[model samples]
Target: MKKKELIMIGLMIFSLFFGAGNLIFPPIIGKEAGTNMPITMIFFAVTAIIFPVLGIIAVAKSNGLKNLAGRVDSVFAIVFTVATYLAIGPALAMPRAGTVPFEIAIAPYLPEGSSVKTALFIYTTIFFGVVYWLSLNPNKLLDRISKITSPVFLILIFMLFLGTFIKPMGNYAQPSEIYSKNLGLQGFLDGYLTLDALAALNYGLVVVFVIKSKNIIEEGKITKTVITTGIFAGMMLFIVYMMLAHVGASSASMFPHTKNGAEILANTVRYSYGDFGGILLASIFTIACLNIGVGLTTSLSQYFNLLIKKVPYKIWATIWVIWSYILANMGLNKIMEYSVPVLLAIYPASLVLIMLALLDKWIKGNTIIYKAAVYPTVAVSIISTLDKIGISVPLLTVLAKKLPLHNADLGWISVTVVSFIVSFCIVHFSEENK
Candidate 1:
């Protein structure tokens, strides 16, 4: 592939990773982080960009998540891969991509007395219609998005970022809540909450397939290109995140009571663009969400097609698009409220899997290491996620909260490290005796 092809691949990767839910994260970080915005951004970049880039590289190096995760065993590999797909598919992400933009941009601007549900029904019908059509044509997916959708989306974002400078919001206030306490770790956890890292692991396959379709059949070359593309994509995401966070940080004093990133962004856009700003913001939201819908539906179709050999890609696309449409209409705030804790149930393990996959190149696929890392992290994650939704598991939650970094929601970090060490020692001693 030439430079142009590499650039297109980078753009396509960005488009896939740039979902409405992800976009809504950074600004709130900026708001709460306040004076610590820079520190939060550094940690945010780690969770939001570095981890996801690592995921992409791990998948590329191993050729797929299946192979990367298979070191844990076949049952784990299949189950983990499928769960990752579903979490980012109709279960959470795909639906959010369809609904968040609508809630943030379109619904806010609707005329009074108009039926919101009816309007949503009409909007999603058209939205998923485009998604289904574009997803069905996987070969043209990169071109349609990179050349058309992504550029428009980027331009709109650039305008918003630039506008913030031309007419600034006021200074950031004092840091709030956890951000006031531990900026870096708080931002890191917040970034993890975005779930983009998991998305990147799955997205690598889409980019690899796109490159293969371009006649780059050599595995080494393909993996190298994917890694480079992943870096470029990460850089792009960082830039976008920084810009959004800057907007949020600045608007903090101006809009202190604003609840979340979406509200922060909506306020900034309106302030910058005046009366017509909402329209421009709506355009940005639609383009951003539409790109995700297209990329996700296409990628999910590709994945399910390979997994379930009997089902045609078109049939899978049809099924998912319809399901996502139904979920999307359920209301974005509700979908978001539900998505986080459910994802938390899986995220710690998912991150552990990505870490193990990266280390597997050295560990040489040690199941002991995999088991050590996975088991405690998963147990902690379950207890933590349960606590998050007000479902207390009594002794477990109490014990978990006492673990170091538990207040930051990273008690599992210590668990991951200690378990790996203990497991390594046990395996080494047993093997030496043998």
Candidate 2:
């Protein structure tokens, strides 16, 4: 491929990875981090930026979607592949795509006395209906809309940031309880919950499919192109995240303390550019989210078509649209709450699997060594999920409570350590047996 084309592909990949959560997360971190915003930004960027870039590189290096997860085991590969795709598709992404439009766009136009829930219900139904129709023919039109909307989203965010610098929103407030003690560490941990790294693995497959269709790269060159594109994409994410964090930090005094991230974002934009700015930000987010909905619906339909030969793409697309609309109508808060536990269960395992995929040559895929590495990874992931949902897994919770960092999020870190140690032992045992 020519240098110019590769550069364009890199930009496209970057935009694809930058979605709703990408826009919301950094600002929340900044607001909570208060005076220590810079340290928080750096920490947030590790998982939000660095890990996602690594995921994209891993996908590019692994050859294809199947190969990426196949390193662990065939059963694991299928489960991981399907679960990851679903997480990014209808299960989470689609409903989010629908909700953002309602919360950001439609809510602003309604009368002060109107019901937000009722408006959300009507808006999401229409939104997903359009999403379904457009997804019926997943062509260049979806690409065109995304290309147009992505830049608009960036521009609106830039305006918000620019507003922060031009006119201050009072001085920064005191740090929140979580941020007061271990600002950087908390910021880093929060970044993991954004789940963009998990999204990157899925988006990488789309990137590979697009590249192959264009004949820009052969099988041998796929890895190099993916890695290059991911690096370029990561750079873009870092810049955008920094800008948003700056906006959040600077405008800390404008918004009162709010438990929900969405409210904080809404208040931030309103403070920066007034009501007009808030409306504009909402419009951009809504449109960008709509494009995401189209992309996800199209992808899910194609996946189901492959899995069930008799089920047509159009039929599945319709089903996805209807289901997503129902979920979206349930409201963003509900969707987010339901999704957290599931994401907690899947993300750690997915991260471990992606890392294993990238190191496939050294590990030797699907051997006893690989299964051993995988077992501990799975064990740790289960513990992580249990902790995330506030569930006390009797044995693990007892063990965790006994540890030094037990009170904090450090229990998950301990699980991670045990996973690595167990993996090492497996590799050692396999070598000795050989």
Candidate 3:
């Protein structure tokens, strides 16, 4: 591919993955991680940047996630694929994307006495309508996202970041207990919560299509190009995240303690530019969010068409638009409350799947490895999800708390490692004996 073509492709990948909710993470991490920001961000990058890139590489090398996942079992493949798509689609992400622009970016700018509920309904209708329209044709997603939405979103975000440099907010403050005590691990856990790796698998499919649209016919070449583009996308994420985190770190001394990255960003912007900052920030969020909504609607609709073959793509997109619009009207907080538990339940399994896909050559795609690693991780994640939603199992909660790195919400990691080792031993020994 030409340089210009590669840049456009990279931007498309970046936009597909960088949803507006992503804006809410880095700053909160910086705020808490404080003086230890470098170490924290390095760990954050390992999960957020590195693994997500690897996920794309895996999908590209395997030609698709379904084929890779099928190494576990066809039944598991179908179920996991559908669950992953839906979790990132209308069920959670789309609704959250529909609402987030307003909650984090736009709502602050609304005139007093305006009906927030009424405004949300109006906004999401247009948002999902555009999403549905864009998604109606998958071939054009790269054009709309990369050529139009991505550049606009990048410019607006860069404007916000630029102000932080032109005028510093304040010095980074001392970290809170968890961040100070367990900085790298906490940051590692924070990165996992981004859910980008799962999204990367889905977006990897889009990359394949985009490359084909350019007439790169060979699978190996497509895979190689995708890996290169993935690194480019990861670099973009690192730069953007580092800037956003720096903004948060700088604001810690000036602004009072804020609970989320969005609040931290808003306060910093308002301080720098007063009333007009709200408008600028709102545009950044609105564009970023709308890009993701369109990308998800397109990816999911196409997948459903392939999976079922009965329901058409447009129909699926319509269903998503309707569902997302309604759920979005329920507002951002409710959407996150429902979505977080589902993501918490699924994300560990996703990471395991990605890691295993990377190691498939070494293990020769052993079903035993996939089974051992993912099954227990899924179970632990489900219990963790239940605990998160306050439906606790007393003994399980105690066990989870005692696990290595559990304090960082990685209770499943220890269990997954042990399960994989034992399963590998059993599988290897049995084969040798036979």
The root-mean-square deviation over C-alpha atoms between each candidate and the true structure, in angstroms, is 2.1, 3.1, 2.0
Question: For candidate 1, lDDT tens digit of each residue in 272-345?
Answer: 88878888888888888888888778778888888888999899999999999988787656766876776777
Worst ten in a row by lDDT for model 3: 330-339
Candidate 2 regions exceeding 4 Å error are 112-118, 133-142, 171-177, 256-260, 331-335, 387-394, 400-434
Tell me how far candidate 3 lies from the true structure as C-alpha RMSD in angstroms.
2.0
Against the reference, the lDDT scores of all candidates come to 0.83, 0.71, 0.83
Listed per model in order, the count of residue pairs whose N, CA or C atoms clash below 3 Å is 0, 0, 0
lDDT of 3 by residue, 50-72 (tens): 98888888887777778877888
Q: Write the residue-wise lDDT of candidate 2 on 273-300 in tens digits.
A: 6778667677757766766777666656
For model 1, the superposed segments whose C-alpha errors exceed 4 Å read 331-338, 390-395, 428-434
TM-scores of the models, in the given order? 0.94, 0.87, 0.94
Residue 229 shift from truth in candidate 1, angstroms? 0.6
